[model samples]
Every structure is written in C-alpha cells, then in structure tokens.
Target: MLENLKKEFLQPLEEFTPIPFWFWNDYLTEEELDRQMLAFKEKGVDGFVIHPRLGLPEEIGYLTDTYFHYVRYAVKRASQLHMKVVLYDEAMYPSGSCHGQVVRENPAFASRGLRMSARESAEEGELLIAAVKREGKTWYFWEGPSGGTIRGVHYGEDDGEAGAPASADLMNPEAVALFLQLTHERYYQELKEYFGNTIIGIFTDEPNILGRCSKEGMIAWSGNFLEDFYRQGGNEQDLYLLFADTDSSEGRRAGERYKRAVYERMSRAYYRQIADWCAAHGVAMTGHPEKSTDIGYLQHFTIPCQDIVWRYVAPEEEKAITGEHSTMGKCSSDSARHRGKRRNGNECFGCCGAPEDPYRFTMEDMKWYLDWLFVRGVNMIFPHAFYYSLRDRRKEERPPEVGMHSSFWEDYHIASDYIKRMCGLLTDSVNQAKAAVLCRSEKLSWEIAKPLFENQIEFNYLEEELLPSCRIENGCVLIRQQRYPVVITDGKDTPETRDFLRRLEESGGTVLVWNAALTAQKIREAVKPAETFLPPARDLRCTCLRKEGTEFLFLVNEGENSVTTNLRLEDGHICQIWDAWNGTIKQLELPVQEMKLSLGQRESLILVTDRGE
Candidate 1:
C-alpha cells in the first residue's frame, strides 16, 4: 500500500489540476471558446468555473437566451475536451441577489439593515422605542421625548454605498429561494444532462447580511427580525443595548446572543437550504461565505471551501491582526476533515494586494501563495479569474489576469503540475493531528492559532457545532476516527461549554483555555508567548496524516529563509523523507529517534514511517 501510494503521489494526477474562474462576459464565438478550453486542457488545467462577470455587452445579456446558449455550448465543449465545468451562481457577486433581479421584480425582497438614531420626535409610527444610558442617566424613548428609536429600513441598489445593487436578504427565506430559483435552478433545468457528470458543482460567492459597512455602529436587520428575535428566545428590551455604549456584562451577553441568533438564521436560510437542494439535484454545493474563517459557516457546504485571496494576511504584514496567508485555507480544510468531506477548495488570487493601486502579482508570488495553501491541506484551487476579453476597458475589470495574457502563461504547466503532485499526496489521507483547537471566534482563533502552526504542532479547528458529537476516552477526544489528545479553546466559556470541558477532563483528555478561567481544571494559555525551540528556527509548519497504518508528516517552511532543524520522532519509528519534487524516498541518515534536516525557502517535505516500526 505504501509503495502504491508513493507511485500515485509521484504520478501526474489530472484531477488535482486547478479550476480557474473563467469570466464569460463578451460574446464569445464557439471556435474561440473551444480554443480557450483546449488551451486550458493543454496547459494541464482540468476544469474551470464559468463566472459571468461585468463588461458583458447588453446584447449578450445575463441569464437571457444568448447566455443560456453560451452555457450549453461551453458545457458541451468542456465535455468534448474532458474537462469539468463548475457553474458560478451569479453575474457579479456577493451572490444571492441574482444581480438585483430578485429585488427588481419583488421590491420587498431588498436587503435590509437596522439603524439607531437620536430622534427629537418619532414621526414614523413603526419605529420602536429605545433606551439610552448617557453619563449615568437613563433616558426612555417617546413620540416627543429625548431618546432614540430603532428603525428597520431597506438598503437601495448600492446598499447605501457607491457600487452595484444591493444583495438579496440572506436572512429571509423567500429572498434566498427566489435567488436559487432564478440562478441555480435555471442552470439545472438547462444543463440537466450534465448534472452528475461534467457539471461538478455550483460556486456561490460570499453571501452576507448587512452589506459592507463603513460605520462601526451598523447592525444587520430583516423584515421579520423583531418577530424572529422574539420567537428565537431573544430579549426585546435588550435590543437597544446592542447599539448603545454599555460596559455591562449582561448587555454584552445580550448583544452576542442576538448576533448569534441572526447568524444561525442566515446560515439556515442560505447554507443549509442550498446544501439540501444540491443533494436532491445530484450535484455538489461548493462555494464560500462572507466570513470564511468562521468554520461553523462552512458546515453545510458539500465540498467545503473558503476565499483566501483578497482578504487574507500577506507575508510582509507579520504583525497583522490576522494570521499568515494560509489561515483561511486551513480553516476550510480543517472543517472539511472533521465533517467527513473529502474535498475542500479555495477561491485563490482574487484582488491580492491593496485595493487602491493593486500590484500585478508575479509568477514567483503565485508559487509561494499556492504552496502556502497546499501545505495547509487545501486540495482544490480556483485561480480567481480568467477574463473573457482584455480588449478596451474590459482589461481593468479585476486587473492582473494570471491567465493567457500574463508573462508566465506559456509556462503555467510547471506550476499546475507541481500543485497537482502535492495535492495527490495530501488528499485521500487521514489527518493525524493530536489537538483540536476550538474557534470561539474567527478573530480570537487567528491570534491563538499561530503558535500551534509555527511550531510544527498539528491541530484542527473544531467549530461550535461539532462540540456535541465528539467523544472523549483515554486521554483523547475522538471525532470521526481522528483522536485529538488536547483540546484548546479561546475566549469566555459558557455553562454548556464548561460542561463539555468537564466531560473531556473526566474522560482523561487534556483541556487548555485561553484568557478565561473555567470550573474544569486545565491549562490556561493567556497569551501565545514566544515558543522555545531546540534548533531555534520555528518557521517550518507541519501536518501529520495516515494511510493504511503508515503515517506521514508534511513539513513546509512558511518563511523566505532556509533553516536546518532537528526533528524528533517516536521511539520505535523510522523516518524516510519522501522527496515529492524528485519522486524518491530515502531514509534519514540518523537513528530512528532524531534527525537533522535542511529545508530551503518555501520548501516542503513528506516524511513517511510505519506506525510502530
């Protein structure tokens, strides 16, 4: 089995070839489309997501007769070329709105937001009375009194900003249902023949409530928010405290609870329902949410994915509030592993640098980015964009076309092949992490995760939803066949969370908490202090995976400088370095316990060993 695995890993695995985001805007001829598809095939790309984007001429309108005609031709050509086609579910996105068509028809389905303002007299009869505590004085709202009122209002075409139209109300089921019917179901109806075959999945972009906000005080709201809030056991009186400045603990808890309920409803309406639809239609739902690093939001995805390009921390930004580039990728991959999903993807290389004056990323930068994600267990890649036309003004649509127009277009196969080989080894293997790090929140997890990532300590981020299903025994917590020896959590603990911790402790698993003290006796990691190491260079990140009783350790250097480090293995095991690039396996030239290894800049190594030698 080990020998076969090694051979397979070394071979050119076609399925590992990435799917680039093919932007179909201009009216493309059949010949040109066929030529591009063949070009991708010859360049070692196995698939593409047909993304309808801006700059499309009015004649070739979105979701019209011409559009569906082009779709059929594209899918048919893809079938002939032996490449998969993923359906991008919107024209331009934050998805769910069907490019404002949902609201254009049904004006009531427009996205909504909540605002709290000081009003001398509430002219609108619908406004709810709100309370304000200012300078130790409590003020109550009235029709002509000196307090504030909370109003639920609609966001117009640009979501009250300067851009495209507002998104559909993701928290509202009717709006999301209309979006699916217009976008997803339309594709399904037209491409039924290719459903279970070449049409691999539907890619939905970041669908969120409360459109991008400029002010800190903005809150998400829906038409039925008040009714839903009360129905879901939320306190009506505490709604005012959410928007007000209050340092009280009860107020904070109330606000957190309210936001969580909103998130739950949004997740249900958008993610769960879409997932169920995909399952019934014999296809996979493969896309991402707005807050991609929050692993809980990825639970409903069939293939589980995240976008790592525009928003993730860059290499130069070391002290960034977010972790390194691989942070979001790891979150998606970890969630997939825990949930028994075989594949996880990333929408990579989209709007990489600063929004203003975005830099055109070089081939070298692309390699490092690809390696960062692949090392962290991401198996599938969506290379942000491939423009339909770089002609005229269309060239500046998203800029930085890493496709045919780029300098490295002719040599893209080298990068693609390399990624394919790495992915082949990474997938179909069980992750051998010893710890399950719980993400209390995406921000907190980002701060806490770096220590474990940088020190070659392998762990998976356990989401809030997965806590109940886990079982602990013999100093290990078992979730789906993987055993986590330690469980680390960040932030405040609840009675429910505390109970879970106590149960883990009682079952003999080590529990570690950050910042807060729990009733359960465990290790408290207040801050991620500097880690002390034997050889001293802690830039190499590692992951352990198992296949047929043989264990493998994948170590990758996240830094630009090379470092020689010492690796220690279990007492009874022998380590053999599987040189992935060269496709050769050789034993470490030392005792079975410890070995010194040299790693180059951005280098990765796969070490294989028997379970007990």
Candidate 2:
C-alpha cells in the first residue's frame, strides 16, 4: 500500500494553495479586516500566516501593552471564524528587531539601517522615524504604514549600524536570544494570557544570526565568532566590516562559515527556543530561514524546526542549504524554481514553486524529483508563495499570487485545489520512504548534485524532473522506497559515497555514481572500485535480488529517450510482475527478455523481476 501510494505522492498536492504568508493588518480597519478575511475564507485557504505588516506602521514596535490589544482583537476575529492564523511578529518581513526608519532613515543613517537599499532610500528620501531609548540605548523603527515607496533596495545596513539595513540583527546572541523570549512571553503577555481566545502562533521570518540591532549609529560589532574568529583567523574585524559579500578568500571562508553557523545557531535559538515558548503559551511558529539555502544547517538549527523549507538564490558557491555533515542510509531530494536564474518578487518571488503557467520542468520533471525526495523523508509542501491572482504579469510586487492573474474568486478556487492536492500527497509522505538516492563521496558529486539538489520543495532539495517518481520522508530529501540499480547521483567520494558503493560491493546492491569520479588511474588503482555487488546479468539494469522469499530486479534505463524494458525471472519468464511506474499490469506470451516501451526523459523504471505465479 505504501509503495503504491508513494508513486503518486506529490502529484496530488503539487499545486500552490497559500504561500507561507498573508495580508491584513493595522492599515486595514476592523471592517476591512472582516472583508479581507471573509473574502479569503470563502476562497478556501488552509490558513493564514498572519503578521502586523510593515504597512500597518502604528500597530507594532516592541510589543508594548497596547500592541497586544489590536493583536488580541485580530486574533479573536481570526480565531472566531476558525482561521489558521500564524502571527509574524510586530513588524512585517523585517521582523520587529530590525534597523530601518524605526531609528533614523537619514541617507547617512540609511546605510546603517538593516536591509535598506542606499539608492532606493536616497531617492525616496528620509522615512518616518520612531526610535525608543531603553536603558541608554536608542532602538529604532518605522512600522508606519505601507511597503512605502521602494521597489528594489541595495546596500543594507552592516555599516555604522546594528548588523542591518532594515532587518533585525541576529549576530548579537543576546539580542537574538532575547527577541525570541519576548515575542512569546513579554511582548505578547496579554495575548498569552488570553491564549486560545486569540492568536494561534508567531511566524518568525528570516531571522539569521545578526550583529547589532540597536537602531543607533553605535553598536559593538563583535559577533558570536568575532573574538575566536579574530584569534585564529586574521583580520576577524574586517570580516564583519563587509557591507556586501566580497569574494576574497578571507571574506569567502569567513563569510561562508559565518553564514553557515549563523543559520544553524539561529534555527536552534529561534525555532526551537521560540517554538517551545509559544507552545507553552499556546502559539505555533513557522517560516522560511533567513539563509534560505543551507538545508541541513536549518534542519538542525531551529526549535520546532520549520516543517517547511524555502529555496532561494545566492552565490554559485552556495546551494542555499547543505546538510551539516552527511548522513546517508538513504534520503530524498526536491527542487524549486530555477536557482541562480533570476530574482524578482520578495520571499515569494520566483522562489515560489515553478511558474504555474506552462509549468517549467513539465510532468516528467515532477516525477523525477518526487521519487528522489520520497527517500529522504521531507513531506511538507511550503511552496515559495501564492500570487494573489492568476493573470500574473512579469516582475510584480510583494504578493506573487502563486502565478495567477484572475480575481480572488477564480484564483482562490485554483489555489485551494492546488494546495489540497499537494497537501494530500505531502500528508502521507511525512512517514514513509519509497526508494533511495545514492550519495557519492567521490566528492566531485555536484555535477550530478546540481541536477538533483540544486532546488527544493520543502526545506529538502530534489530535482523537479525527479519528484514525480519519489515520496517525501518526513520533510527532507527524496526516496525511492524500493531501491533501484544504477542509482544516479552527483559524484563525491565522501564516506556517503563509500557506503552506497560498499553496499553493492561488499554485499550486492547497486548505485550509479555519475561521472564515476574515478579517473583511469583511480579506477585502475582501486582495482574493482573497492566495493561488492550482487552478481547477476551484467546487462540492461544492474542488480537483481532474492531475499527471504521475495525476488526483484532493480532496473535502470539511463537513456535520454525511451528504452525497452526487460526482466528475466524463474517462473517461465513471468510475462508481467507489476508495473510500479504507472501501477499497470502487463502479460507477455513469448519469452521476451525485454519489454518495449518509450522511456520518459531522465526516467527510472523498476519492474518486478519475479512473481509467485
């Protein structure tokens, strides 16, 4: 049953329902809120990842006593109607602890603001400011109203400011740690008291490990690793001084590790910490990582750990997210939009799922990835976003609308259905594995890796061409559920590579490491690739197995075009076993060692080599 279901897993819920976000805030009056909620509610959304939007300026800042009132009111309304409401802190995307106008939006100070673009801000001029001085410190803010006159931004704050542009500073461990504490406890005191009466949980946006979040021009730049980094590493201070990513060897190594460590640490600090706190006070936490790449970094970092992972772009040297070390028994891989392609929208940009239009990679692309991730255990479908419409034009604003351009009613219908389909597959995916992907420590595996791990579905990365045939394990990587010979993979000869190769060598299983990583010397030097394989026919698909009373052939059709399928078995060349691919059954009269069928692109088909008949 699990095997059969795994085949069609992602197919069901592979559409965009609602991205991990929403709209409706202080700007929208109580009446407006009612109308928006009612409109969306009728549209059949799973829930809303609510926030006090940047557009709702007067609504947030420090989560004071009064802030809770509006929140409570909103929560009550949302809850009364049984809406899934996720509270995204006081501010909008920047989170509440950022450095924008809340402090000083002056062009000079703007550079100091977190995430603020120098060119954009200067053009727009100074923004409304409202800084708070707590214990001899000037904390800034500009939670005024609206996305407020800015298209693209550049030069975020990392200069004379608190590790910022217009976003929160996460490097200052204390600030980060404290911010987590307050959101669940201090900030939402009244709400926490009211609990189930209002507000479900909080949505913490890309809260990466930051430096200084104080809105003031002065802040200690030392980060979690600054001291030690400065000690063993030369010019540690210079590392922190970079306004943008510099490719210097010093900068690269330092910055990479900084980004990696920050991602991991913050996940633990915020996801786990804040999640636990929210749970205690009756709130749930969910959002993508600030460092959208680094999958494993995120997996081990956050508290509750966002069941949903996001895929975005960075330098070519980065994969968004890479697992901590490497753990391989077996796992899955997923894909998102084309990484390193283009950047248009916000969090929901192209990073959302594929373009809902022509559907970029195609059905085969979907099957290709599904099968891979099914092995890894990632079952949740938090697509990049749902555009507010179906008639989506190119390069629009924040709300990407899941690639739609139709009105709410029409778009909602399509989105809700899409969400349901994806949710259904992912729901079942949370617990099983259909097959496995091989990880080669050949170390040079990225050639094969890029095709498989370059993009993501949830937090896990899997090539789209591969998703249709796989099942998500628990929310990460791809899985075949049933192993297949010629397991295609990027070639890297790490310990991971050795094991898969060893399984086939020492005992008899099969894994195809692409590019073979071994040069003539390496292949000849190793003399037989240092592993074992179950001996059988050395043609067509590689491995055939008979364990206990079960017998099967792990077939592989690596050809780009269609190839004939074949299976030689004990029972008078069993006409047909069971076609796992499309769940069809076939019977051939004569002794045909090969079954003729057109193989889909990048397709892997495993035929039952034997049967009881």
Q: Which candidate number has the best TM-score?
A: 1
- Which digits, one per residue and each the tens of the lDDT, describe model 1 over residues 1-613? 8778767766767888889999775767888888888888888898899987666666776688887898899999898888898998776677787776777778667666555656544433234445565546554433111111111111122334444555666788998899889988888889999997999889877876754432334466676676666665656566667667456986777777776777778887888889888998888999987775666778888888887666364555552225534468778888888889889988887877444556476677676677678777888889977776787766766656778777788988877777787777777888777777776434337656665665556677777667788877886878886787778877466678778888888887777775544421222232121122247555776677777667777777767688788766644455577776555678767536556778887577887765464
Native-vs-model 2 lDDT? 0.36
- In order, the Cα lDDT scores of the candidates are 0.70, 0.36
The 10 consecutive residues of candidate 1 with the worst lDDT sum are 145-154
Cα RMSDs of all predictions?
5.3, 12.7
TM-score: model 2 vs. ground truth: 0.51
Candidate 2 ranges with C-alpha deviation above 4 Å? 1-20, 57-67, 96-168, 193-200, 208-224, 230-272, 300-408, 430-446, 450-613
Pairs of colliding residues, candidate 1: 157-165
